[model samples]
Target: MTLKSIHIEDTDLQIEVKEVRKVSKIRYALKKLIYVPDADLKPKIITKILTHIRNIIENKVKEREEKDHEIGIFIAYKGKFIKGMVIAEDNPHYSSRNRRAASFGWLYAKDYEVCKELMEACESFARKRGKKLLRGPINFPKSVGGYGLQVEGFDEQLIYGVAFNDPKTAPSLKEFLEDLNYKQDSEYLSMEVTQDRWKSGTQLDKDIKIRYLTFEELNNRKDEILDILRGAFYSVLPDAFGMERYKEIMDLLRNIPSHYYKLPKKIKLENDSVQTEFVEAWKKCYDREVITFFHLAFDKNTDNLVGIITCLPDLYELWKDNPITRVNVDVAAVRKGYGRKGIFSSLNNIGQLTGNMLGITYYEGTSIWNLNEDAIRTILPHGRINRRFYVFQKRIKNPT
Candidate 1:
């Protein structure tokens, strides 16, 4: 791919945008050495940044080879690399109109002025590609991209699976995007629930049975699981992945080895009762060290899948203690007819119970859209709001 370069007069910064086919190890090391300050925050902070950077490079290369999607990386430099962003063209399964988006992350800059120029370059690059609308801080897809900007709740530590930038940079980036006419497209709220607050109230109808997917079942019935996910989120997230892309993503996730996860061994309750049942459930479902948990609700009368909740071990925290202390609730969806039947609440109750049994202290749930009042209500009872993230978009004046 060709490298595109431009100069911003306002900041006197030279900007370059290019497709990242290969990232040199030396350059990667240099970035780590230069950008990371030698301070108390260096070790944990640097590791987080480096891990994300590596993922971006690898995904960009794979995107290029597939040729089904378009992705590019942009960098701002005066004498050296100051800012960077990633842009991609997304084809949602349900949307008829073509869409393009960009994610600005691993964002480290000297000042806000440089950040502004970097963002402008990203917008220009997207427009040149004939994109009508642009949305992000999202990497490649909503599932993997860690969507949104941290608009509120700055006092807390960053959680796993959620996107975050340097406290210094995040506020300025938000200000720049707002000033540049990027309107708020969407908002997601993050919240946490304590094990004590996770009380079970109403139960599902007698006909409805809650079931956990075994490792063998996950492999044999992967397609059904994907279908349930796509159907559940189709209305709420119209821009969800298409069938082909959905399968591709699942395949990638399924291939993850066991060692990457820290499995739950034993869970004890406040009553001093040992929860061996929870440990046995986990053992039955987890064939490897993968940290994903899936719970499905089935309607016996129709013998159909009605609801699903997916959770994964908070990788950031897991790696630190080598234990499943926290979990990130990735997605929770109920089929149309299944709504208002307490399926959503039941699934969460099960999640909390399972997590508690495994010694998990907290559960992190995100991407709860502002318009989703029902979901917000369901979560509010069990979790406290920790952070809010926003997606901004602007329409291009003229398409190619």
Candidate 2:
């Protein structure tokens, strides 16, 4: 049983750190924040961040206990006009946040000053404990949930299964984190997905055929697609190396539900052992029939599945009118030899046309940080780019 406490000046704010699981009331209170009435969520728009808070406390605590890390931090805030709270744990082995690749996710804070104070305490605690780096606003580990802050797109709100934050909060985060020599990192880029890309005449020749994947075929052929995904991504992306690291990758392929979410880190290794399980899980999580996948294969000469794309229809409505889903084309890939052939241009053209026919009014894309540069180029002729977000990273110890 270990604990600690702290206080701020001239305010009711006090922070406490202690260990206790199964806090039921707080969990219920948190649920309220998750679905706060949109009307009450006016002005500051501080909609109850209960979902994030609940994750930090309950699920994350279980993960820490499993990892056997002995230190945890908790804080409660009572400010002049706002009340907030946070919880974090010091456990590097905690693996469920995204897929366990994330070795650090600790120190939760709510408001500006308290967040700053909590980060300071975290830095001091980590320094005293002799840890290498401070890595998260992690919920527990990679498999669970962990998304830090968005330094780039301040105007964009988060989507389902993602974090939503205030723009002002990001600048403060930059100062606090950078001052501590902590680096910034991002997952994927959201590019303007337009319909005009088909102008490249990149579609497969009449000889090459485009086929929709049947559920049975999609199920049976998961391993092959997974293998290509692994091989194509591995050498280029060093972050996704081992099977455990690919757990999230597999999970993503299995459960994207048409509203895609990027992996915590890019996939840098080549191994597709878990693709079957991943796709199966995805099917269970999503029941929207309009969502579909198209896997492009070269002619009968070879059994190669070179070009691929996932298309979602009516996603704009699914997101409750959130513009992020206006029309999303994701997980697009094309093999090396197959490049320059119009495979990707063809896929984007047909995919967007299909989406438009299905009632999707807008088109969008979230590009992984290290994916094919050509795939992006192929989309240029089709649609207009609605947004462009940058990804940045700085190693903590390599500050120069």
Candidate 3:
């Protein structure tokens, strides 16, 4: 009950919304862990898995580390029962409203009333930091919750890094947000692609060399490669996949903290993973040994990096103790002048061929935004939409 408070909502019922800032004070917080695969969800994750998910989020929220600053709020009914919960946090990588905003995600509510209370509570949390707008359902940037509420394509297979509602018993968060007047901020798509056969790995063009970059090459050419990336992505539409996250990663990729090198083993990104910092995110799937899948296209004559595609193994499979065979194609882009040429296709084809050679059987083309016509046209053709993601925004009233 450290920072508890009672408030009233604008609805007809005039219910009392009690806030609990400390997770320990509310033992009923874990009740929201129930799970049932709904109209769209498949292969329901049991309550233990949900408990694991809650632990990772709860620990990070409590730690309040550097750019990962976060707060978990529980909307209590009559000061006891847990009606709903939401997480408010600062995302330094977020590119919207000139980056002067916060995110509200890791959401849950039994009904619209609790959802409304949670959303407004997040709004108040935003304004206190001098922000006038808030956006999300981002959930957190890994499996379970990738970047938005699913609005379409529910019958398809679930992929890594895309957000999905854990418990189906509650009203859809998408509907609740719409009822709250939260407008669409961005739209994204995830597609399932497969390469049953290998393709020609021959250099597509005499001037364009497509090859997998080993860790040595990446470590050596990171500065030159990142410069090209910065140029290609800097002007990309904000809130889209071409987010400012790349710009923020310059230092993160360049300077690996001491802890990263000391990890007991290659950290599998899951509920037990404690690697929360941007550096530890190991988000960049650096090709090592047979894991060589990150493909880069370069100008043979100019010897300048021209295009790139990045990917990572689906870490969730580790939970089932199965060989990790699926991959998430997280990023793919060609420079401004490099478009329309076969550079992108060449790089991607080479990526697929090499991925299959390394025992990878499935691929999820993720984070392709609808607003980025170039991305949609290029990526959607590979496979049908597996899931649709959207970001929502609502204006926050200034704090008095």
Candidate 4:
């Protein structure tokens, strides 16, 4: 890209546009560094992911061209064209799952001021692009670019597609844009698995029978297992419950090597409205057994499923080679009024017992804002700490 113009004033700086393909080269380089040798990301796979990014940019460019709008990203500091962003039009469908994610690209900057200038340039370009809203630090949603801004925490390594920036970056960016009439848009929170405040309990072992579904039993009860999952987490993570999305998740889950461990085969819901597509999908994505480890709490008088704990093992490997196996407690629920009745306590005891049998010395459970801490405390006898992730936003209109 070629430089467009630069006007430096006493306090404010005016940046000109530029023509440079540095963004492409940077993305290509990052991919090469992170490629796992035996991983599924072969040449074709790499190309496809890159193609997705290209298509988004091309689509935005086409829209600007046809609409007679000016859509161009400017380099705030030409010395290094390090950051990039995709200008979007608007979000027509804003539901949690079907949100119309327009701008789905990454934005990086050396400092807060430079990022601010670039944001302005993008906004100016957006006006010509016929856009009515502005937001990011994200290229897309978490499923895509790991959406939002970094506010609370800055000193942490970012996940594959997640975004991170200096602590001052979000506040500075927010203030700058606010002064320019940008309104506060939204707030998001990122949490972590901590080990500070939790108090361990043995109730799980005392109350519930916890066991890995023996290879044979799991195979025969696939449908029932998924039903339990559907019933267990449908209320918490609603997105994963959608028929189509659930199928995708299930396909991913089925691919786990643990499926061969007599893990349950996913059962298809008999109702026409409830399809069995998630079964195959689970096989594609998950690398471990279906319902790697599960717990069922029962009343001494009645043998009914009252409380359950479902763990996903993909994250468990993060602590591979170490004695402790960090498992993401994907689903842990107890019927209302039963929470304090030692259901979770029993589940936790069973999980730890099963972990011990499998040679796993430790366990890690991920958490976020507004999650029930008491139940978690019942499981984690040890204390917990706080870890922060980015929560960013931009404005759709100038503030009053």
* Candidate with the greatest TM-score versus the true structure: 1
Error of 2 at 337 (Å): 3.2
TM-score between model 1 and native:
0.74
How many angstroms is residue 333 displaced in model 1 relative to the true structure, after the best TM-score fit?
Answer: 0.8
C-alpha lDDT score of every prediction, in listed order: 0.57, 0.43, 0.58, 0.41
* All candidates: TM-score: 0.74, 0.59, 0.71, 0.50
Q: What are the per-residue Cα lDDT tens digits for candidate 1 across 234-339?
A: 3446234445444543543464445433344443332333233333445644555433457677887876778888776655554355555766787778877777
lDDT of 3 by residue, 142-201 (tens): 344566776676655455555665535323777889899998878888888744322322
Candidate 4, residue 78: Cα displacement in angstroms equals 3.4
Off by over 4 Å in 3: 1-31, 34-72, 166-171, 194-203, 216-235, 240-291
Candidate 4 lowest-lDDT run of ten: 237-246
Model number with the top lDDT: 3
lDDT: worst 10-residue window of model 2: 39-48
- Per-residue lDDT tens digits for candidate 4, residues 60-117, read 4343322332223343343433333333323322222233222323454444455555
Model 2 alpha-carbon drift over 4 Å, by segment: 1-4, 7-13, 17-100, 103-113, 116-148, 151-163, 205-208, 230-235, 238-291, 312-316, 319-325, 370-400
Q: Regarding lDDT, does 2 or 3 come out ahead? A: 3
RMSD of each: 5.5, 10.3, 9.6, 10.7
Better of 1 and 2 by TM-score: 1
Write out the backbone clash pairs for model 1.
258-289, 267-357
Q: What is the per-residue lDDT of model 2 for residues 85-150, given as tens digits with 9 covering 90 to 100?
A: 334444443322123222333333444565555555555455555554455554333332324544
lDDT of 4: 0.41
**How many clashes in each structure?**
2, 34, 1, 49
Ranked candidates (lDDT, high to low): 3, 1, 2, 4
